[model samples]
Target: MSRLYASLFYQKQVTEIFSDRSLLIYMTVVEVALAKAQASVGVIPQEAAQSIETICTAQIVEQLDMEALVMASEQAGNIAIAFVKQLTAIVKASDEKASRYVHWGATSQDILDTACILQCRDALDIIEAQLGNVHQTVLAQAQTHRNLIMIGRTWLQQALPITFGHKLARWASVCKRDLARIGQMKPRVLSVQLGGAVGSLASLGNHGSAVVSAFSRQLNLTAPVCTWHGERDRIVEMASVLALIVGNLGKMARDWSLMMQTEIGELQEPAGNGRGGSSTMPHKRNPVAAASVLAAASRVPVLMASLYQGMVQEHERSLGGWQAEWLSLPEIFQLCSGALERTLNVLDGMRVSPEMMQRNLECTHGLVMAEAVMMALAPKLGRLNAHHLVEDACKRAIKEQRHLKALIGEIEEVRQQFTATQLDDIFRPASYIGNIQEQIDAVLRQAVGAAD
Candidate 1:
């Protein structure tokens, strides 16, 4: 009724970035850049660029009649047409001659698409900062728990032993890869769109290419090989990357939620005065951050599919497909921002209990360490024979309610081959961790190398 995951965890920074004011500001940015770009090629006077730039602030755009603009947009089939008229009117009041060239050679799609790219670039900056924080938190977790032994579960059941740091290291590796993807895609996705009417630049004639190049330079964006009026792959690719990054966030949420369960109790979300609480149950400190992240993960795919669907534009310009991106991109960015913030909060406050981890490790009654005990005897008893012997011992140990090590000594073949010290060392969970630190180091090094 109120909001999913509640308004308590709502991220204001995300909401502000997609606000009506923000959108208008970016659209005005595109218009000012257009004027400045035209001036660079002698299409518009330099004084006009200066005049347009002076009044293009968000504060100025906020003063215009947005409701009237939206009402006017319905007849025009889009908002940018009415918005450009408002800009022209405002500029006319200040300097009449400059106002005539306000939206000179650009179509609505050019202004709208370029404005969307500007917003997206800013949104990615916020996302990148949050993601970096997550990377640092995960890396710290791995370094802190490098030797914290825990049970590794498969199919929701204990399967083997692993160091807690190893699990954290895996998440760190995922964050690093996600950052790399964002960096690679930003250049391609942040390019300006300046094809007029039908991706032809017909109005500007010989000066179109120069204006386009200048527009990109003025805005500090890349110049595309050609116009992308009907080509929607850039937005689609960006949506795909955002969806993938959120999927990784969902993975972390699922793992933390499971580990926080009473039966497992190996990990916990941060405890606070109004965080992760259940209204009726006093015993319930629900993993709300994880729930929020998981909710976002589940919801984003539908929006992403819409972006993908928007890719099917017809001819050099599309009627419906171009309209689809207006809302979907903002929604996706907002969802990712909320999810990223909650995830970072969860990581910052997360608590790992080695005591509980150790207790749970024994819940399997030494069955999880089977691989370790089995390996130690493999060389002595021959691989097949040793596996058979340990497998038989495991069954007996389970039935007799005794430890695996207790039963290993009773087996004649095992007793004949090894002494008490060998069994003692082999059965320890510490012995089974096996190069986890080295693996962690390698992952950290690889992430650092990729960054460099």
Candidate 2:
């Protein structure tokens, strides 16, 4: 992580979870857990396991020369190799007999992969909690604005009337699905990776399977049906899910930033001291949170792709492909966490302008209601004739700089079909938002049921 942009793009808790020191600690945890599991399965002396566990403390891990370990990893191909050496030495210093089994019957990839899985479990917990917060905020916004009328845009142009609640409910539905995806993925992705040297734990003799089960129990992780040393699908699946989450956040950010435009001031990101400000433009309150989220969204897909590419390993373990995930996966988690935090911040303090939404709805001079007008006249003029007549009135309204209601009223055929009061009702934004409350309620029911 860079000191320059880390604060801007990384969440603190997640960053700490993926930090080098934290990684070292997690690796130590795997080493300790492995010893205990081996001892439990009668593969190692319980006294030796106790020695390894007691010696491999956070203090011992912190005392190691990280720079030297990292430099040694340059030739070792991965940090796990160098890390195991230091860990062995630390255990040896306390008890010579115990040091013999520091990493007995295990490979470097086992320690590294299991440690990374532990890290992911912690990181995902934070992400899930933050997502729950964002989802709750979205639900609250949807409920509050369920009846607030606004013009729905299509291809960047006003199309028809809709409630702001309807827009928020759509966002809420995606969040619900994202939450579900995370839940479903955890079981598969959070399993233990315990294959030795090759895919089989050949070094452990008859104790491999038993050791794996005990190790999983020790770490509170799932014992997979088979080793995944070469199978990178679980890791890639996690990266893909993280990318999906950021993509959803990006969509929401794009909409919010567009809505915050000066010409369309229907929404604003949360304002605070020095928040969303421009250095030169004193009048600017940019959508900084949305911009950050969009930036993360843009970057996560490529990182996830690299993980996907890394799936093609040479047999049991990869050469360069497995190492590729050493950085990419952490960055994905970091960026995904940052995006979630930014979204929650925006939702927490965001300002919604029903008045501005109402004003913008009329900016088109009632052209947005043409569909309603057409439908109303369809019963009398026939669907095709009504569509043609309303289409003509819309063009005339734009060309003559007149309200569509006025232009439609002047149409001899339209006047013959509908009275002024009926036409007035057709132009009301609220009148055209059909079943919006029901739609919003349906989404809310799903959300509320999920909470239960």
Candidate 3:
């Protein structure tokens, strides 16, 4: 289920994708594809290729002793060494003659890199779908509250009045751009890795290019222009995109957390019997989903840096650089997956308090509408005079604990410039939200097109 965080808030699909079992399965898959590629060119017997395919099942791959395999991998410099050994043994048991062609004409880097790409392909599907869900959730919020008035804050202080839908639609627009970035990254990151030793394909001689083409077809991946043994740009780009996704989610969480504060009380994450409960304080409705999303966001940048560091590989092969990716890539995918799911859940069930938003708008005592009043008086007085008059009124209103609207009416300059009804209109929250409906329509139109 896509709801991978419902039970205990742990994502099982992400765990399974990068699991030890999955590693062996994809490695075996790569080896079998290579065998099939070789067989297509008559470099190896077709019977051996067929046998390799039969024994590469998840059940058979799990039979090897994992403890010894891990120790051997530490000594042998790569897991593929111990893994191919075990795979050769398994093939030998079924048919002695077929064992010779298990991982023919391929380097360990080829097997591992292609396997990791396969895993990335799987992770991307999940992320893209979840991104669509987030886009839809934000779109729904915008459409539902398109005209609902709220105070927009700058530097954590009330600055002006804006529709809640306008705020949500801005996030939706950002998410639409994120989806575009993911689309652009897909082709770049999904290319196959099939180069032999030193990336020259010298092991397969003249048949190297043919086998590479066939192998890419077998795995349903794009053929790379050349071997990416030392080129780690695609991997780094993917990590960067995931980091951006988490960062954006974190921003939303931070806003939600702040709005849910007791003083603000304009929003709340969905509440259930045990969903966001406090251990001691009965009144505390904690932001559990935001906590996970923010934590992932906080840590993803460092993980992305590790992938960027991996881009500095040694010629045709890397020692420490490739090793950095072994743990970092999987960790990036897992953290991003969990963060995406949490953000989706948070948006899907969150509650909004329109009344509270209205109340909070009045908390500043019409200071949020200072710009509106200034603009209405700008043509009557010069721009500087209007600004000074409104600015003086604001200070007086704050000092006397009075509304700016009422104080502005008493000013001679403001009274000469505008009538009582005009002054009242200038202070209204809805009067200041310019073109918000048009913007909402435009954002929703793009979102609908994206869904198609």
Top candidate by TM-score: 2
Cα miss at 172, model 1 (Å)?
0.5
- For residues 1-452, what per-residue lDDT tens digits would candidate 3 score against the true structure? 23444333335687688888898989988998999989999889999999888877778766888998999999999999899999999899998889999888788999999999999999888888888899999999889989899999999988888888998898888889889999988988897898888888888889888888999999999888799999999888888888888898889889988889889999999888887788899878988888888888887888788888778887879888988998788877888888888888878888999999999999989999999888888888978899999999999999999999999999987887789998888889899988888899999998878443
lDDT of each: 0.86, 0.91, 0.87
- lDDT, candidate 2, 1-452, per-residue tens: 78779888889999999998999999999999999999998999999999998899877877788998989999998889999888888778879999999989889999999999999999999998998899999999999989989889999989999999999999988999989999999988898889899968999998899999999999999999899999999888888888989999999999999999999999999888998888899999999999889999999988988898899889888898999999899999999999999999998889999899989999999999999999998998899999999999999999999999999999899888789998898899899898989888888889878343
Best by lDDT: 2
Candidate 2 residue 410 C-alpha distance from true site, Å? 2.1
Candidates in descending lDDT order: 2, 3, 1
1-452: candidate 1 lDDT, tens digit per residue: 13554353346676676777888888898899899999989998999899888977767776789899989999999889899888889889999988989999899999988988888888889989999899989998888898899988899888888998999999999999899999999988899999998888989979999999999998999999899999999988887888888889999999999999988888899999977777898888798889888887898898888888888989999978878887788777777877889899888889888999999888767777788877888887788888888898889988999988888888888788778898788778888887888889977787678434
Q: If candidate 2 were superposed on the true structure by all CA atoms, what would the RMSD be? A: 1.3
RMSD of 1: 1.8
Residue 17 Cα positional deviation in candidate 1, in Å, after optimal superposition: 1.5
Worst 10 residues of 1 by lDDT: 1-10
TM-scores, all candidates, are 0.96, 0.98, 0.96
Give the Å error, residue 104, model 2: 0.8
